[model samples]
Target: MGRIPCCEKDNVKRGQWTPEEDNKLSSYIAQHGTRNWRLIPKHAGLQRCGKSCRLRWTNYLRPDLKHGQFSDSEEHTIVKLHSVVGNRWSLIAAQLPGRTDNDVKNHWNTKLKKKLSGMGIDPVTHKPFSHLMAEIATTLAPPQVAHLAEAALGCFKDEMLHLLTKKRVNFQFQQSNVAPVNTTHDEKDDTVEIIKLNLSRAIQEPDMLPSSKPWDFTGATSANFAGACNAFPGSITGFQYGPSSFGNEGAKSPWSQSMCTGSTCTAGEQQGRLQEKLEDENGGESEGGKEIRNGSSIFNTDCVLWDLPSDDLMNPIV
Candidate 1:
């Protein structure tokens, strides 16, 4: 059987509700309530279809309709709900007292999605942008080091998620009061010398690095580590910091040059040289700095490293 149309297209009015039509619809519904929309338009002398009347009443004519700008709390609730329910805008709207499904959908497309993207979050997946980029980067890694790349990428993702959700991450390195190195010094100066020592130690035994996990970056090679560092400019999680701890000038650390060039020195030789430099600079390690031997400390300072997991990168509600 062929389906019947709800109303005759020739006879019914279309586009834009008039004051008379609004008053007619409102008066009819007020008098007898919306028991039958199809019958109400006819009884109210409105040339509009039942669906049109229904939309007009529900979206605009309703006495309880919220017709102002959406509040911040309301916008947040909509975004949080949308993350879980996705494009099921009607369901999301149901949770919000005054919003309609169309309103919610429009707001998400026009406003909220851009806001999330600006924060480096995918609006649909609710995942960090850097995390997604890292996943793609790991696939290009050599098979022998693929697992290491995956682990390192996972750590990076977790760090991004932690930063997005928790607002702050704890690590000795991140919290330490190391003075920013003067970047204007000669390339062979003490600052550059210290950066080389710290970079070699960081690359050789990332497992010993104090972070969210001790061995999160265990098998990462110097080349891959340097690439990761370059890929994320300021912070491990791709967050921006005023000054980089590796050197004063953010990603332009002196050690990055050595790593990028693939230094020929073995890990043992690098470690030895790094230790000598550290001793020379500090005039011997402090009693509290014993952790440096185990690779638990770098840059001759107590500091924390940022790391993250692959799953649940953002809080479900945020």
Candidate 2:
């Protein structure tokens, strides 16, 4: 008996596969199951190698693939998750169920990765600040708000401490606004506006919003937060600073979009020069409000959001 190679050259061919071959290979596996790829073609009457058969089965023929263009939120989640996990398409896919590793890998290479790179975001950092901000806004609730409020207060204290040291040096020579600096102990009335502004900026920033809301400390309020801000040398008046003081409303400022843009927002209006394009398409319709609201509606709650298992599993629908 003459010996032929494991993949008999006479019967087996390599390179591009045809639809008939595809159907035969698919049908054979669908019936008998795929225990051995090398032997599959021999029985299935395919002229392709086992390797080719496997590749076609896993990449294209598999039934589980959820094919289509990725939605905006999926893009956002992918970008944000990618920031933390760089290049791990399998891991990233696990977090986005019904999405295959190959699909995500292709999407990242073809679309999202470039978009993120163009945005000047370090794709390696995996920290999609814009998406991160949206997540914070959508995830945070009243209880979470208190935690963030405290974080802001904490940041305020740190700034005040730094400012005090600077103030002593910078203002020692200049005797302006230094006349008997109201050395009183009234906590509420004797507060300084600068501290309030600094605190608000630190706390309200969308990225920081997550850490601000300490989930463990749920019932924490502004009054209980006095000790938290005690480290702040200057007194704090009221929470006078809101979103408006930041000039965020309707403003195309980067800070406005990065932090102020709500969770449920859409894409078409990301400001910058891109705003003109979006505006033109919408006939000058504002992309800021309705789009964002739509995104928010997609993930109504963290319960639903977190409940979604990552799409990284090999369990394709097929």
Candidate 3:
């Protein structure tokens, strides 16, 4: 009797409630309200333990309880919330209007878990089951296609920084010139001349290539993108804007390997720095000033150079 177990007293009932007992508990709670569990059973004239009374009232006899099968949207919500919160049944139940925690847990264990497993998804991680993917593609994805993913990810980085920085007066600018790539061979004698002109004389800049923008990074983040090295890639061509990159044909920049080194893109950080610089220069935050400052950036090159990258960074594999 000292510890609470919903049935500690010798005189208290232990089995399921009969119709008569249910009525007594329900009717009493209907008028008296739900509070003070220890006092409820005594006041209701029930032979059940105090905690037993509370459980019966909350789980079964509660007037607002939701009943019947869950809807399609409800099921989806459960799966999605479980992925985010993970086994926190109370929190999950709160999101579901009238469903109880015990009900939500039971549904997940019996139905949703099986459903995800059958579809080759691990219910726990909400990702594809490893056995479903027996072999991963071993051959390197074409560098051109893969670089686009990197660029998309880079844009995502920039977008995220802009959000986090709260529109601080800052700017992002980039320019790059393409030079040729030399294989793992000795440095070519004609590397410097290529850098002096845009990509060994006349490769037109692609529409997707990033243009030099003064204070607004919105241009680079847009979807209409086709890129040459004036934006991204590394260690191939004499391109020095986005990163060190190789080109299909042209004189190799001597510093291709050492041209641009970054573990992760710093374009987003550049936004933060520029905001501070502009604000300090103008004596306050500049929402969208057309200061027209064009130069190299953390992820770009200085000077107007249309540096093209290796063909691998632009084309797709067959």
Instruction: Indicate which candidate wins on TM-score.
Output: 1
Q: Pick the candidate with the highest lDDT.
A: 1
Q: Where is model 3 poorest over a 10-residue stretch in terms of lDDT? A: 129-138
Residue lDDT tens for model 2, 160-208: 3334443431212021232322324342222344334433333344343
Off by over 4 Å in 1: 1-5, 140-318
Which sections of candidate 2 miss by over 4 Å?
Answer: 1-11, 127-318
Question: What are the models' TM-scores?
Answer: 0.47, 0.39, 0.41
**Model 3 spans > 4 angstroms off:** 1-8, 131-318
Decoy 2 TM-score against native: 0.39
How much is the lDDT of residue 54 in candidate 1?
Answer: 93
lDDT, candidate 2, equals 0.45
Name the candidate, 1 or 3, with the larger lDDT value: 1
Q: Report every candidate's CA lDDT.
A: 0.49, 0.45, 0.44
Model 3 C-alpha lDDT per residue in residues 1-318, reported as the tens digit of each score: 475554448988878999999999999988898777777787888999888888887677877788888755456556655654568776556555567878899999988775554332446765332211111211224454344434433433333233223333121213433343342223222222222122211122232333342112234432212111222212111222111211222345322322222222223443344333323333353347634333422223431111223221111110
